[model samples]
Target: MNELSLPTSTEAAIRRVEELGEALKQNFPEYVFPVEHSLHGGMYARTIRMPAGTAAVGTLIRVPTLLIVSGHVRINSGDRVYELQGYHVLEGEINRKQMAWALEDTEITMIFATQAKTVDEAEREFTVEFEQLQNRKKEISA
Candidate 1:
């Protein structure tokens, strides 16, 4: 007879991601959510631009089982570059980065997780949200 072994930490991380994804879908039924994953010890970055003369605000929430290096940038005065914020987080860590900017600007969010398990977990969580969003879109189009 073979004895069953408990899941390692990586498997636990993946399971946590799945749980979070379901929670997001149940809680936020109005907005489209996209989740994505990348390799461990890699970088994740994004930049968004708002229309001229408008202001924008954004938020990022990371779970406690992943490591991340995060930062943001704001463009002001039409050629001046400013670093808005930056920080790092490891497992059992929780942090929030928020920004408000004006005058036709761009903001960027970057994350780097230091383990393959972390990336895989993120990917799983994202897949759940993406599927829900796609279904919503289809309903709207129909």
Candidate 2:
């Protein structure tokens, strides 16, 4: 049996995510992760649509989250690469960067834990992941 493996090192994962994000951005300039709903206090969900043949990279999340993918996608979750189609769900602790390619037009919903009082606050939380990772790197370098 052939088992698919993914990049497991932190540095390699980060680099891959950065490259994937840039490539995706160049191809899908209008791609955006908008909040889809709030799941009770300190929890929120956001969704992004990836056109077929496009890919996206995600920042390191400090907390565990749920990922629901609609349509076909190939995903690298730092430890494994999964090829999924139709409606699929992934839930785990996602403290490392990840990348995904849309085999078909895909809508991905990410549900995460946060301490935000409103959608704006939750969005801010989402944007700060990269900064947090950067700070961690700086601390390691110093």
Candidate 3:
């Protein structure tokens, strides 16, 4: 999908990101003002929780399309971290090592990127699978 096809939902995505930030603040009081950012093509919000030895923990929410990639992490080194197993709207769980940083006591920095191509590919696959299911159902029903 191109920009022109997604103009209306872009505003909704921004609003959702803002609302998500507010919710995180209210829910995770121990975490300081979570860093929130909206780039030209995508939006991201993250909050950091520092609990001594094992670096800081962060919860990140990102809109990479209609697919909302939300997950948590434990930042070990300066720029290295482990993405805790969790859910994204489209990919479900991307449990892997990802990069993150601590800006200060009150904020943590995270990078967000668009997954438009991935989303498109998954949609196409789902469409094909769905058609196959429909045909099977028709044969069985007949």
Which structure among the candidates has the greatest TM-score? 2
Error of 3 at 55 (Å): 6.8
Q: Give the clashing pairs for model 3.
A: none
Ranking 1 against 2 by TM-score, winner: 2
Give the lDDT of residue 86 in candidate 3: 41
- Candidate 1 residues lying further than 4 Å off, grouped into runs, are 1-41, 63-93, 114-142
Q: Residues 33-107, candidate 2, lDDT per residue (tens digit)? A: 332556576688877778888666676665566778899999986646789899876764545678888899889
Q: How much lDDT does each candidate structure score?
A: 0.35, 0.68, 0.32
Candidate 2 residue runs with Cα over 4 Å from true position? 1-9, 23-42, 126-142
- Candidate 1 lDDT over 38-118, as tens digits, reads 454444322333333333322223332332323443422112223344543323223322223433333233344433355
| 1 against 3, candidate with superior lDDT | 1
lDDT of 3 by residue, 43-142 (tens): 3322233332222222222223333333443322222223433432322112222223233222233334543344333323323332322223344668
Residue 126, candidate 3: Cα error in Å is 20
- Please tell me which model should have the higher lDDT, number 2 or number 3: 2
Give every collision pair in model 2: none
Q: Ten consecutive residues with minimal summed lDDT in candidate 3?
A: 90-99
Least well predicted 10-residue stretch by lDDT in candidate 2:
1-10
